[model samples]
Target: MHKEGKVVPLAAATDRGARTPLPCLPVLLLQVRDKAALQLRQGLQALFDNADDTLFEMADKAADRFDQHLYFEAMRDLRLKRKSIERGFLDIFYDTFARIGQVDPLGFMAANEPSRNKAQMERAASVEGMVARVLSRDGLALDQLSLRLQTLLECTLAPQHNPLGPAALSGYFLQAGRNLGVGLRVKLILLKLFERYVLRDIDVLYGEANQLLAAAGVLAELPPAPRRRAEDRRNDSRRISATLEPDDIGADSVGQAFFASIQGLLAPARGRIAPRLHAVATAQPIGTADLLRLLSHLQHYVPAAQEEDDFDLGQQLEQLLLRVSVRSGTRRRIATADEDMINLVGLLFDHIHADDNLPHSLRTLIVRLHIPLLKVALLDKGLFSRASHPARRLLNEIGAAAIGWETGSEGLRDSLHLRVERIIQRLLNDFTEDASLFAELLEDFLAFSQDERRRNELLEQRTRDAEEGRVRALQARQQVQQALNQRLRGRVLPQVVVQMLVQSWSQVLLLAWLKQGEGSPAWRNALATMDTLLASILPQRDPQALLQHVPGLLKALREGLASVALDSTATRDFFQQLELLHLRACAGAEGPAEVAEVLVAEDIVLAIAEESACAPLRQPDEHAAQLRAVQRLRIGAWVEVLDDDEPLRCKLVARVDSSDRLVFANRTGLKVREWTAQGLAQALRLGEVRLLDDGLLFERALESVLDGLRQQQVH
Candidate 1:
């Protein structure tokens, strides 16, 4: 009964004088399938977790309200249905494996399946297309995965029949999502996410499954598949594969369009500006290499970060070109291409220097990289033609990080500011003929910023949740106070009744409103009970009506009081006092000082609502536009505030509607400032605060320069 690679053994049994052997092979296969399912379950959990964050980020970054709401709703739907979807996938997987050995060939034919309608057919085609795309992308890994599965089962299985195949996995996911209230684009985005987070490492899944089956004496050994790559990584110029991410498909096209617009401006400006430059007509033009060397030489002398008058790349280049032409006796001129690069770089940096989106300190640090960037641009034209070019991305990353920076906070000591300064200095000190430095720095900076962003986002979410909770509590308290005041103010009542109404009844009212809202039956009942208690305490001519209401009213009061868990002794005393008041009302009498006193006295307790703690509903009419601007600001919008202290940089993390308050957090997601709509509007009107444009810096600069050239051409 021994077998090679067998880890478990079964006892041989006999029944009714005949030998009945167990199906050991099927049992072993089931064990292997279960082990593989466990691995897949873990992977699916991670996929859903990452998907949650991705959807939230998309919602935050969405350009329009419609898209934002769509993503947010999808996120909520996914959260509610995630467990069932995962269960459905595993159920299908387990059932598929269970039927592998038992399924009849004829029974599994197409004739046995139900016919699909037109919409179903279209949806099926779309799902199949998605599966086909995924299979095509990871064809090598999938082929080997299928081979391993077939070897273990000693059977040929089509993709749909293979429990762990891409088709099966996608089919179940699509079926589950069919009922999800999301648009086609969102569905496609989720499919892409599945490819990235789950299927991206599918080879590992099959590898572990194969290993487990082999250990259980199922195909103990097999030939290893040859290694292959999904995409080519070579020195030759080629567009980056769009398969890398969902948004990368159009990145290169956008970059090409930018270059086209830039070249349009450069061509006309070059011809008109050539005669103005005295060096252009001096002598033979120097090669781009010689121009780079001259720029690199001047780069070393660039001023430090704290220098008031920064190093002007254009001024220094002009000086260096003049000296070189004079010393050579035969005047040297910059080549057409080199001259255009210098001019374009100059215009780009000039725009950068004046960009109000970036803080003055960051602008200074970024300007220092002008020479190095110009040199890189001269060496590789991809700087303008490729969005993913290292130099261009590094510049973009720096600008993106500086979007929330402020003028007066930490001149050079800020972590981001320091990191940018270090990178710029490294380029100036190390960069020459080699342009790979940009790529190296880009990788390091991306890792650093990613970790920083994750921490900040966590803190920012907590801040938002806390502010929202505070707002909810304030609103509930205010609602309870209003209800109590409308019923009790200016009315004569006993001190005991007032105390119970304000102290005990107010809690009960607040709890009801907070739990079920103002429109719920519970909130309405709570209000009715307060009114009944007040009526029972005052004089009532209709003794019969008052007598009939006393029992139900007392029951409702006791239940309300019990819901809030007041002290037993206190509850007993309150009920006793209420009973006496009802008795006196039925007898057409009033308690001591019940008619002469009013709840308007300062000594009376009030509901939890405090006017000072809440923001005002409106601001002065003169600041109407400012208020509208504040209202228009999104959650992630960055703003710079100029106060009596240093200028503070922060992003709007939450808007508390109950208080009309805007909560702002710094880059580290620490609550740095907050203001009501009125307060913020006043600040904006007084020129003490402004919004920052957080768009990509390079793109903005290029567009600005192009627009300027277009205007000049028209003139």
Candidate 2:
């Protein structure tokens, strides 16, 4: 029992001398158990009936274990079955437990003892305290008190090694009934007292503890509390500021104080600004009423500043306006439509009302522009009131354009705002003298918009034309190269000479072939001259002399083509190609003195044999071809060298130059090596090197060296 606001341990109550066994103790125990079982059965049947499969399963499982008196097993099965049912079923289950608790309080307390011994003891003390408080006026009998204390101890202090079995309360009642020497009537009255007080106390304590846990968000057994209204949520969100300490301000204290002061100053105009500010804060679109209210409040600022000189009202008002202006500038950058324009103004007022992030100095400068802006709106409400209004559009455009204005640069920020102010001033000045200025402004804006569209259209057309011309020129080059390759087939010539002819003269061929029979008389005559020059370079002619004529022949071809009126850009491109090819051919010819390696300027040869014919438009599998070519290169194999900026020339690999460089001999038999092994490997990978088998040629050379070595040995 609990006394003097403290829980007196059950051990203290049990210290009293033991009582003799009570007569008919067995009958009393049977009566309490029967009553409890009857109440539990009636409650479960009424609640479930034929409805719940989980309840039916529990009944079946418990009935099978009835021979063993496994009431604890029945309760465990009930817990398991309850998990599979709807959440609403828990209410009926707890109610049934409550009804059973009324029939046998001690037994009910034991059965529901918390799984943890510590928690069960704490709960027993709490229930004991409640019972003591309720029955303080009517003291309990010693025997009754002793019985209740024993029951509480049995339920709470029971060793929890296997709590899943029958309640320890049963053992306590059995031992007490055997020990106590009281009659059946006295024992039955004590049992009634246990049911009335201790059981009722347990229910009250359980309910209170559950409520506390649920309120603290620790218990999920109960339903959640109702949600707060929207207004309440907003208030709760803002409540943190009330508890903010001075130390919390830190470096941003000035900004915070300035905002607070602005809000205080604007309290007088709250009637006009509050509704508009709320709409903006909630992200709602602004309407005409909001705009009109904003303009009225802005008008009050100027007069208030003029009258309150001592208060520095003008400077404060200026600071407020500057803050609004800066925010408006930010909003303008993202505004896409008319609603955005209206929203911009609403947001500006909201910032001013809240004094959000505004610096003191900027706020002053901003105040100066307010009167001019307001006057323009008064002159033509469309200026600030409507999104599509020309004035509104102009301001938005200026704001967007000024987004990138750097404040660190000298006068840049000032210049941007000045330009905005000048526009406002112009509108105010013109509206006072001539209302027609609005019409002129609208007309000028439309004209500027029209001009921008035209410029964009022109740019797009030019881009398209250039792309088409590029594609056409590529097609023409491909067609001419294919035709020339076809025409040169089956001719025997040096490979270098053949390559030179194709690279240097492909452009001339393209022009002549494209203009043939399609141009004027002059172009036709030029084409004839080009064909004649091309025909003179046959494989039967001296290859060296024909190669020498290449430069002079190319110059004549260009002059003749120029005589025909061709597209200037096309003609320029053709000559550029010719120049590049000429430079490369000249470099190759001048580098080596071997006439066998050079071909005459007029000589045109088809070096590709029948077994290894070159397909003009057919691209080879470069990677596979290069790998095969690399495999064919023996110690003294002859090969034609290919480079990005140099013309083709024959070479012999002298030896491996270095780890990363390759050595080769020029056509004159001179060492002219400067190739990197990695670069050579890449060229080989791209199939740039062409293998020329000269095994027999090298065999004879080797034989001569062997004979010379034998003679030296004889000497």
Candidate 3:
């Protein structure tokens, strides 16, 4: 239109329509760990996880969707935090904030926008004052007011405030800001002043926010909160009334709902189906004493199992114990993590440990209570080899204590100085007189032992499952290796191998060689071939669409074939066949480097898939059996596996720890055999396992695991 001399005034037109930008937090500056970017990305993903608006494609592009201004605000805040390395300044700042567990800026901004409006007006008014003097009368025009107003906003401050910082005004504006240039300028000035004087500085409004967050965080930290969702508040109130002194019930206005819930719970129940519930409406932070009382109250409603089973409380009791087990205790400070965790664990353990208080028969039931919490604790601390310490000790104690209690009767003996031979005799004498009470005591002990046994079994089973999973992964890789082997034996063509083109050719070669390309053909040729193969195969697998995962599958196959266990020719031949197949399938053009961006290989399966290798790291599912239990464990618990070592030589993951059998996922059955306070030292130690990004280490360890499996199969 401009070329045709239509004179469509772009700036004028846009300026006419441009509404004033609302006061908003700058886009959030996320913590970047290269390792932890995934976490930031995940949190962002959750913000748009629903069907409303989730249009981000590239992880970087997601920045646009975030309020960049808010992010800039955050970045500016971080800069003010301290002079840091720009190379990774954002990452470092965010990492520190994340570790400190600060609220995400965007979330806070969204939730508190109305709260920010007043502050924005004040800052804008300050700017309006300064800009008033500078504006020519011509700048006062209604048509150009918006354009001229932007000029002051963009002005760099005179060595006092950065351009990104709002400019302060000496005076304020009350009205007509859009129509009058002087008023607009004054308003802008005030906006800047507010930012500089009171608003942007976190100290001003953080106290109340902190208080609110602390209450929510503590409640979230407790495992029992979620399950109590369905309970009647009236019933809960009654229960608490029965147990809590009247003064204790209403000590906190913050705990009013809690009291109400207590009152409802203790209200006389009609029958077995209508026992009391526990309080939950209160968001007040719970003290240790309060938690214990709540736990006791919850236990009261669990309904006896059966009339004669001696374990009176049925599934309700079992579930209550499970709920209690989920949140081990709140994560307080790391220095006292051990002490706090030990005390909490000790409280529960000691409760069961005392046979006289409850009875020896209930030990198994206590063990059952311990299971879900123990699992959840592992999840929280699993990523850091260092964090696993408390969990490991906890597990070990359970095992050791169980063995000790079962054989020697320490818990029971403390309560009643009786021999194992006389335990049954004394038990009948104490409970048979009151058949119902006797059943209650007997069931308690039975539940204790049975639950402990179940817990031990669950741990042992999880360990075995993890071990077998590692073995299966190795076997799956070996199947590919065998295919390469047949090709190497002259039964298959050398042109079949495809990895000569991948960047990780060296690693791939460790598993098997590409037969098609001469040697290390540019990854470009392999990519072209890959594209061609994908396009062609797309038609064949159209109905099935297995090719969607082919890229990663291929990468895994290459990794399997590329091995350097000892410069064996068999490995070379295995890869040759892979090369031939790769060439036949690919498009014959190079693949985009963009593939490297998203598909940063994190494990063996990913290593080969140049474009589809990496998978997003998952947080523990709250509903999943893990996170709902224990949390904030120290990193000093589990054993570690490190570097490119062979099996048995592979670093230990977790030994028979006195702490607990901290669970690990061994994709490659490398046991805990390394040392250092941080973790595996190479890959980020996740739980008991290492998540590897280093290609060489990945291939080497996977190969070692595979070789071990091959030998085992042969034997």
Mind giving the per-residue lDDT tens digits that candidate 3 earns over 1-715?
A: 0011223232322222123332221111110112222222222222222101111111112246444343334334333422222223233323322222222222322455566676555543444443442232112221122221122223222311211111211221122122222232233432332322222221212222223323433122322211122134334433433332233221223223322332332223212220222222221233433333333443333222222332332233334434544464432111122223322332344444443222234343443333223222222322112111233323332333332222123534532213222333333233211223322333344335444544544454555455444444444344434433422333212222233323233343323323323244533343334444334322232423444655665564444434424244655654554444344345333422112112212222323322212122233333322221222223222222323342111212333332222333221332333222222221242443332221121122224433543455566
lDDT accuracy of residue 161 in candidate 2 = 18
Q: Best TM-score goes to which candidate?
A: 1
Please provide, for model 1 over 1-715, each residue's C-alpha lDDT reduced to its tens digit, 9 standing for 90 to 100: 2133422233212111113332334445555565566556655775686566557656755789999999899989889988887877676565555555443222222342577555455545655665676566555556655665666556786656666776666665665565777776677667666665566556556666666655655545555443334332211112212432446322344334445556756765453323424435556677888888898898898888777765665566667766887788766666666666678888999999898788887897898888898887777665665555678889998998888865444656778887888899999899997877787898679768766876798799888877876777788877887787777777667778888888999899888987889899999999999888887877788888988998999899889999999999999997877777777776664444343334554333443443334223445546778888988999899988876477778999999876778988988898877888788888788787887888878878988887898897787
- What stretches of model 1 exceed 4 Å from their correct place? 1-282, 308-310, 318-329, 406-411, 519-521, 535-618, 622-628, 656-661, 671-682
Query: Cα lDDT for residue 161, model 3?
Result: 20
Question: What is the C-alpha local distance difference test score of each model?
Answer: 0.70, 0.37, 0.30
TM-score for each of the candidates: 0.63, 0.24, 0.20
Q: Which candidate is the best by lDDT?
A: 1
The Cα RMSD of model 1 versus the native structure comes to: 13.6
- The window of 10 residues in a row where model 3 has the poorest summed lDDT is 50-59
Model 1: lDDT to the true structure: 0.70
